[model samples]
Structures are given as structure tokens and as C-alpha cells.
Target: MVMSLLLALPLAVGLWLVTGGRALAVVLARRITAATAGATLLLAVATVAFGAAVDRAWLPELGVRWSFGVDGISSPLVLLTAGIGVLVALHAWVEVPPGGSPATFLGCLLVVEAGALATFAARDAVLFLVAFEVVLVPMWVLVARYGDAHDPRARTGAAQRFVLYTAVGSTTLLVGILLLVATAGTADLRRLADQAGAGLGSGTQLAVALLLVLGLAVKVPVFPLHTWLPPAHTTAPTAGSVLLAAVLLKMGTYGLVRLPVSVVPDGFARLAPALAVAGAVGIVWGGLVCLVERDLKRLVAYSSVAHMGFVVLALASGSDTGLQAALYANIAHGVISALLFVVVGGLKQRWGSVDLAVRRPALRETSPRLGFVLLLGLAASLGLPGLAGFWGELLAVYSAWTPAGDRPRVVFVACAVVAAVGAALAAAYALRVAGLVWAGDRPDPEAPRTPDTTGVERWVIAVLAAAVVALGILPMLLLSTTADAVARIGGAR
Candidate 1:
């Protein structure tokens, strides 16, 4: 409980600084940011040390307790969020100029990190909802205030759309939770699981499942509900984009696994086919859009939709193998997407544009190092074997071929094949970006040439890139950790 509250302290401090007096705010802001970062880092370490420790009934009345813990299911994600928080802090140390109160941005980031960690660690539905929603306000401010000012409309519009889409999803999720509590007579997940099937009617169970999934789908931003993602990614500052892709979006899928599947297994099994269809559609649709996207950031953003679609497909398969694959894919997507966003953010910072065509010809000649890094990131994104992307794709397809008894194996197999096609499309777009930007003509006289990656940027990217390669080569490290949790969730042997 102390560790959790410490994790949340930075954000609280940040909020104070943000709302404080303008005259001395800048000085106070710097102090606040330093304090927050220090405290956050310590708490993050404590969380790892306390690994999987649960404290139930810390608050009995609200049914909200310090029922927090880490597992193979959540530990990796918690580490990812904390690790990224540190890196983003490092990045801000150099990038953010002096005038703007760094306190607010850092505070918001810490808050987002706290929320994300809490979401992953939460064992209770109400606690999860609180942690999940806590992320929204800070992130919205980050985009609307700290993002690119050159296009204020784009920034504000993207933030608004993001809020609207996610809010609707959250409302649905709240209703689903209420229904579950009302029908099942308790909100405790373990208790719900024990009592759900026997107590609730099939129709009621299915309805609750659908409602919860609908809420999660929007956060997963699957296909039609995904409109808010690209614009948000395109307009958000680099750190904001990193957090959004790497941690925030996973909240949806995490909820799906933690809530519905854990508490209402039969309901999820029944809905697997429709879920598979949605995943298939998102894979195809997002891939097609990426192939045509001219903006580098937006292309990467759309690619996330495609990548996450694979995760959804795996989950929808309702097999132990599929669940494991989805877990692998989820973590892989986080690392790869963070790499892509970092590369794109670097490009935008250097060249003043994310337009692939405008920045193309000069990339090889001027920014060779950054270009090479971008290529590596894109290769990982394309699911090249021995990179982080391959395991998930391979496992997802494999699971589709051998689905659980309850699933529609034929449909899942077809979706797997379409996903394969999407993979090929990914390769095409990745190669196109590489060729157009780093392999083609000499320097474009019209476009400005920029410096190669700086020491700090190179160090940050190298860490992320190395992570991608390591995960790709040693997927077993992740697989072993996640397998038990995935099996437990699926009620498999």
C-alpha cells in the first residue's frame, strides 16, 4: 500500500505545481518534477521487489482495497511502464526548454505511469476502472499542451476525439461492472468466478460480457472504434505517443483478459467468433491504411491497430495457445511500437516533418544513423524472425490452427490467413519507407538536411532496439513467465 501510494505521489505533486501560482511556478515546477521522478523511480523498484504480493480488504466499505499484486501476467507490463517513465524523464531532461513548467508535464507523465501500473496490478474491477480512467486526464493535458503547436487544431481535436471515444467505452465498462455486481451479488473477481456460471443465466452473462467487451474494444481501438488513435498519435509529443502505444492501449485488452474471461468463461467462449471477426477486420483495415499513409507517425499509429488486431484474434481463439500468443504479442507490440514512435519522433524533431516523401531523399545522406535505426525498428514491426514481432504472429497463426473446443476453428484459421496477408503488407510498407527514405536518390535540394541522432537519442533508442532483439531471440523468457497466468485465465490444464 505504501509502495502504491508512493507511485502515485509524483502525480499528486505535479497537480499541485500545475495549479499553483504562476509567478513562482517555474522554479517550483522544476523542484516538483525532480521530487516526483525520484519518488516514482523508488516506488517502481519497490513494486518489483514486492513482486506479486497482494493485500486484500484495505478498504472494506467501498469494496476497494489495496488488492494489488504483480504476476507473470502483469509484472512485465509494470516494468515496461516504469522503465519507460524513467526514459521519458531522461528525454524531457534535455528536450523541454526552461520556460514551460516542466513540473506539469513530468507530473502528468508520472500520473499516467501510476495509473498504468495500478491498472496492471489491480485485482479488483473497481480498482482497475479507477486506475484506467486516471490515465486519461493527464494524457489529454500532455497532448493538448505539450504537443506540436504548429498545428494546434490537430492537437486539440485529437485530444477531444480521444476523450470522447474512450469516455463512451468507459461508460459501457462501468455499466457492465454494475451489471456484473448486481447479478452476481459480488464484485470480487475470484468470488465472481466461483459463483458466476451457477448463479447467472446464460443471457445475462452474455449481455454483461458483450458490454464489457464493447468497452474494451474501443480502448483496444479495434477497427471502427479506432478513429481516435492515429490522430492522437500523430499530434501528441513523442513521450505522449510512447506511453499511449506502449501502455495506455493495452488497458483494454488487459481488462478483457482480467475481467470477462476470468469471471465469465462461458460468456467469452460464446462471443469468441464475433470477437475474431472484429480482430480480422481491424487487421486488414489498419494494414491497408498504413500502406497508403504518407505521414510517418500516422503510418506507425495505424500499424499499431494492425498489430493489436493480432492480439485480439489470439484472444478470440479461446485456446491456451492463443492466450499465450496474445500475451507474447501484447508485450512485443509494446516494445516495437515504442521503438517506432521514438524513431518517428526523432525524425520529426530533426526534419520538422513526418511526411515520408518530403524527408525521403536526404535521410540516407544526412541522418544515416537515425535512418538505420528506423529501418531496424520497421523490420521489427514487420515481424521479421529473431525480432520481437515474429513470436506473436507465429503463435497467433498456430493457435488459430488449433483452437479451443468451443471456438470456430475454421473462421479463426481464415482470420489467421488474412492476418498473414496483413503481415506481408506490413513488410511492403516497411520496405517502402526504407527504400524511399534511406535507399533512393541523393540529397533533396528542396528539403532541409538535419543532423544525425544525438548521443542521448542514440542511447535511448539503442536500449529500446536491444530490447526488441533480445525479446525476439529469447521469447521463451517471456513465454515461460506468462504461460501459467494465461492458462489460469483460460481455465486450462
Candidate 2:
């Protein structure tokens, strides 16, 4: 019952807002959305605390059940998705992009939130795919319909690319799931993990892993597959950008953990060397692009590529520390990225554009609060010590440097070296942004002064900023929660 309510509440409310409630007054619509999101967060917490689950026969002939639950692996993601849901909803108080009814826009956010929570909680392979695809339509609507009014063509293109890439990914993922189910004779994720490819031949495991990894890699937007992300972030509204970065991107990494890492150890191990190379490349590629990228929002999007590269590399290590690093990096990036997007998005809102070339007063001189927040985010992004970013990257590199016994030491060591170079690149670009935007030209006496964060916006930024610090200082809060589960998956310990 708890599980059912957890999924249904936001989905039902969102659907109504999009349809019958499309004309809801702006204030009422926002209030309703925020309230629903808050309630959903509470439910998520309850579900996680109690280990709630719901299993029912859904597709008897196909042997798929409506199985949904939370475990150590998924609990943190569930909470993150829920927490982000509340932040996005509250952000409606800050800014609502124009293109559709405010109700429809807010509704879409809830729908996407619902899908993400479901994705995290799904205990069956088929159900996971279904939940994964649930966010695509609503998110596309968000990008295309409620995106920046400044560029209709770019908005349309981004939306189309998002759908195109995700659809292709979903197809591939479906084929992989079907193949795995057929061969393994079950669709339950828990069972699959327990079986761990017991009777499957190496060739079959390789084929399944390839299909699953290929499918998930697109959503992770690994390197070349990452083109769809920057434009989408650039054109999306402040709230949309936050969700895309903090929530949507996570689904891919989580799927990688749930599917490939947990269920097909041998095959994933076989592919680890190549995946490590891709991850290392993505790190360098994203950081180098950020050094030159003019649009602030797009630069953040590129940074996500770099951050997720750490996650992918860690997962490829296939060790206990590697899994822990991947999960920690996943949460750390979520918080840090969300903070960065909020600040960058706010700047874009007030300044009309975040083009670094434009001359303006230094953020420190005009908007001290915003400047401080931006600095904090940038520092964390560069993996500054005692911040949320540091431990995850540190652990990821260590994991790759000393990978599982079966892994090729030479390749992983080389990848770790590349990742270190990427981290240095992260520092260079971060300082570049600081010098350019945080410390701009002296305020023109005649020019308009920039606005600082205030009201609801200030509160939102404070909460996220606080979380970054808390996570950094108390890493055990999250690491210990997943320790047992990480140990269970593939017996890495």
C-alpha cells in the first residue's frame, strides 16, 4: 500500500494538472505542485525507512510482476529523486518558464519525478525499463514546449534529439532485457543477481552485457553519445536544467549498477577495460570543452559528462570500493550539479544571458551571495578537499588504480592516469570560470548592478549548499548505508 501510494500520488496529480487543471491559477498550481512534491518526499522517506515493497502479478504469461521495492542500493537514489522533486517544485516559486500553462509545466515536473522514483524502486527488470521510459515524454514536453522562448529551433532540436537518443536506447535496452529474461528464465532483478549468470555460457553473457551496456551508455551519454545533453540543458528552464542534471542523468548510472554490474558480473568484467577507456575519454572531453564553452548552462552540462565519467570508471573497476565510489560519486554529483545549475540558471534569468564574453560587474561586487554560491559550486566541481566532490573522485581513481583481480592492471592504471589529468583539467576550467565570471570588470558607474539571490531562491541555494558540505564532512552517512548491499552484489569484498 505504501509503495502504491508512493508511485500513484504524483502521477495522478500531475496527469490532472496537465489535462483538466491546465488553467489553474499560477499561485494555486504552484502551491499544489509544491505540496504534492513535499508529500511525495515524505512518502519516499517512509518507504525507505520501512523497506516497503509491492509485488503483484501483472503480466502472467510473460512472467513479469509489478514488483517495486527499496534496498540499500536503491534507497539513496530514491531519496535523492524525491528530494530533487521537492527542490524543483519549490523552484517554481523562483521562476516559471513561459510556453505553456504554469499548471502544465509544473505538472510535467511531477510526472518526471514520479517516473524517476519508480525507476529507482523497481525490483523487476521489465518494470525498470518501463519506469525508465516513463520520463522521456514528459521531459521532452518540458524541453520543447516550456524551454527558452529565445530559440524555438534549438528547443525543438534538443527535444527531438532527446527523444531520438532515448528511444533508440530504450529499444536496445528492451532487447537486452528480453534476451536476459529468456535465457535466465526469470525477470526478477533480485533473482538475477543471486543467480549471477550461474549456468549461462560466456558468449551469451557477453552478448547480453554488450546490449545492456550499449543501451545504458547512451543515456549515461558517454562521450560521443553526450551531444544531446548540452543543448538540452542550455535551452531548458532553470528548473528543467536542475532536474536534467541532478535527477535524469542519474537514472543511467543507477541502471548500469542495477543491470550490468549486479546481474552479469563476468560479462561486465570482460567489457570493463573498454568501458574504462570510454569513461576516461569522456572526463577529458568534458573538461576541455568546459574550458572554452561560453554558455554557463551548457558548461555545467558538459561538466556532468565529466562527473559521470568518474562513476563509469569506478563501476568498471568491479571491486567493493569501486561500487561504493560509484554510488558516492553519483550522490555527490547530484548535489553539486543541482547547486551549480540553480546558481547558473539564476544568473541567466537576471542577466538575460550567461554569455561569458559580455562585460558586466563582477559577481562579487554586485551579487555577493550569488557569487559565494557560485564559487562553492565551482570549488566542489573541481573536487576541492572537504567538499562533496573530493572523496568520490579520490575513491574512483583509487578503485581504478587497484581494480578487481580479473581486470587488466595496465589498462585500468592507464585510465586512472587519464582520469587524474581530467581532474587537473577540471581545476583549470573551474579557475577559468572564476576569473571570468566571479571576478568580472569593475562595475561601470553608469551600468545597472546585478541582483543577488534572495527570498525563496536564497533558501533553495542554501539547502543544497549545506548538503554539499554535510556530505563531504560526513561521508560515512552514505557510504555505510550501501556497504552491506555493495558487498552482496558480485561479492566484491
Candidate 3:
């Protein structure tokens, strides 16, 4: 309970700050963010302390319990969520401009963080769904309120699109959940996993699985379903984009791991080919669009479509290695994409525009540190061997080449080859971006002057960049923790 409150404290403080008014709200907001960050850190530590500790029941009659616990699977994600929450809050100290009160924006972020923590920690399907939906409003408010004010439509449009798409997804997910509960007579995730295969019929199970996957697919925004993402990401503020890319998107992939496989293995097996095909299409489509994207942020947004394609593909393989690769890819994408967005956000702040053609000679000679950091992030994004991005793609391809179960070998092989080509296209776009932004001669006299990165911005970029490199070098740390859960989920099939 204390652990849960620790996660919730930030939201509580954010609410207090928002209600407190603008007069002293800045100070209050900062204090709240700091306090929440501190509490989250402590909660993360306590979670490690109380490893596998299942709490008391919430609804004994329904067998729906408040049974929060962590295993190898959820622990790392919880840590990642908590860590990013702290970093984002700290980074906001310098990033957030002073016009409007920071209280509301900060409060929204805290609420989102709380929701993310709960989503990952939840052991009951009802609890998980509630936490999953709770995150949407705060994120919507963040984009709607704090996004690019110069274009008012950007905020409103982005928020509306995000909400509309996700709401549909959530509705589908809710219907699926209710169906599962009614059929199974319990929403306890652990219990459901044990009985799901034996209890559900093939047709009914497949329908529920499709509902769950479609719900998650919108969040992952796979291929055609991904139309909502680029605009939202391009228009959203830095913190908003970071959270959306790094954490919120992961929720989709996480759901695939936690729910459908656990509760509807037969359905997953039936749908894996279609899922893999969608993933393959997303990889090719996203990469192609990225090649033509003029806006730096939008390009990054497109790249997420490509990166997440790898995750979906890995999951579709239905092998232990594939599941492991999917988990690894999720973490890798979260870190690298967050770093890319942060760097692009910094560029926008300095240059006053994200248009690549308009903003020529993009490297700031004045801010060599920022330039270097941007280059490092770009390298990671392109899956350079020494960076975090490499393993996810490599492992995904490897898993596809040698799947564990009854997956179609030829299809997996073809997808792997095509995905590798997508990776090459990734290199093309990444280099194109670096060259267009950082490689040309000095800008003409009339061009806008680029500002040097601030101390705070440098700190944020450096931390993320370092993390990218560290994870790339030592993936085992993450892989070891994720393996058991991946095995358990995949083993069900």
C-alpha cells in the first residue's frame, strides 16, 4: 500500500499544485515534481525489496484482488517508468517556459506516471485495464494544454486525434475484457493464465484475442492504424513526445505479452501470420515515409513506426527467442526513441523550427556538446553495432530465422529479410537527417541563429545517450530479467 501511494504521490501533488493557482504554483509545482520523483525512486527500491510480494485482495467475491506484485517481466519496466518520470520532471525544470503555470502540466505528467506504474504492477485484469485507461486523459491534457502554442490547432488537433484513436482501442479492449471475465468467471491474471487454454473454445478465444490485439495495435499504431501517431508526436511538447514514445507506446506491446498470450494462446497462433505481415508492412512503409519527411520531429515519429514494427514482428514469431527479442526491442526502442525526441525538441527550441530544409547547416558549431550528443542518439536510432538499437533488430531477425514452435519458417525468413532491408532504409534516413541538419556549410547571413544547448538540456541528453550506450553494451542485464516472463508467456502456446 505504501508502495502504491509512493507511485501516486506525484499525481496527488500535481492536483494540489493545479488547484493552488498561479501566484505560487511554479514553486509548488517544482516541489511537487521533486517530491514525486523522490517518492517514485523510493517506491522502486521498495519494490525490489519486496520482490514477488503479493498484497491483499481488493474484491474477494469476484476473486479480483489488489494483488500487486513484480516478476522479472514487470520489474524492469517499473524501474524504467520510475526513472523516466524522475528524469522528465528534472528536465522540465529548464525546459518548461514560464508563461502558464507549470502546475497543471506537471500534475498531468505525474498522473500519467502513476497510471504507467499501476499498469505495469497490476496483477488483475480489471486493475490493469483501469490503469491503462487512466493514463489517456492526463496525456491528452498535456498535449492539449502545453504543446506548441504558436499553432493552437496543433495542440487541439493532436489531443483530439490521440483521444479518438485510443478511445476506440480502449472500448474494444473493454469489451474483450468483459467477455473474458464473463466466460472465465474471474479476472485474476494469474488464475486466468492457468485455466484459459482449458476453458475457452477455439472460436470464442480467437475473437477475444483479436479484440485485445486490435486494442493494443492502435496504441502500438501498427501500419494503417498508425496514422494518428506522427501528427500527435510532431505537435506534442518535448515531455509529451518522450512519454508517448518511450512509455505509452510500450503499453501496447506490453499488453500483447501480458494478455492475449496468457489468455488466448490458440488465437495468437492463428493470428501470428497476419500480425507479422502488418509489422512487415509498417517497417517498409514507415521507412519509406521517413525518407521523405522534412520535419525532424515527424521523421522521428515515422521512425517509431518502423522500430515498433520490429517488436510486433518478434512477437508474431511465437518462439522463446522471438518473445525475448520483443521484450528487448521494447526497452531498446523506449530508450533510443526518447533520446531522439529529446534531441529534436532541443533543436526546435534552439532553431525555432523543425523544418529540415528551412533549417540548414543544422549542426551548432557553438554547441559541440549538443551536436555530439545528437550524433550519438542518431547512431543509436540507426542501430549502430555499439548502441542499444542493435540487439533488438539483430535478435528479432535471429529469432525469426530460427523460431521455436509451429510458426511458418518461410514466412518468418521472408519477414526477417525484408526487415533487414528496412533497417538499411533506416540508415539512409538517419544519415540523411544528420547530413541535412549537421553537415552542410554555414547558413546564409539571413538564416536564424541557432542557440547553444543549456546546462539542463545537455544533462538530459547526456543521461539518455549514456543509457543508450550502456544498454547496448550490456544487454544481458535487461535480457536476463526479461527472459523468465517471456518464456512463461511464450511457453503457454
Q: How are the candidates ranked when ordered by lDDT, highest leading?
A: 2, 3, 1
TM-score of every candidate relative to the true structure? 0.93, 0.99, 0.96
What lDDT does the true structure give each of the candidates? 0.80, 0.92, 0.83
Q: In candidate 1, which residue pairs clash? A: none
The pairs that clash in candidate 3 are: none
* Per-candidate total of colliding backbone pairs: 0, 0, 0
Residue-level lDDT tens digits of model 3 in 103-203: 77787778888888888888889889998998998888888778887777877898899999999999999998888888888888887787755678998
Better of 1 and 3 by TM-score: 3
Q: Against the true structure, candidate 3 has what lDDT?
A: 0.83
Q: Which ten residues in a row are the worst by lDDT in model 2?
A: 440-449
Rank ordering of all candidates by TM-score, starting from the highest:
2, 3, 1
Which residue segments of model 1 deviate by more than 4 Å?
A: 21-42, 52-62, 97-100, 193-196, 441-446
Off by over 4 Å in 3: 21-23, 52-54, 97-100, 362-364, 445-448
Q: Which tens-of-lDDT digit does each residue in 221-326 have in candidate 2? A: 7877898999999999988888888889899999999998888889989999999999999999999999999888899999999999999999999889999999
Displacement of the residue 129 alpha carbon in candidate 1, Å: 0.8
Query: Best lDDT goes to which candidate?
Result: 2
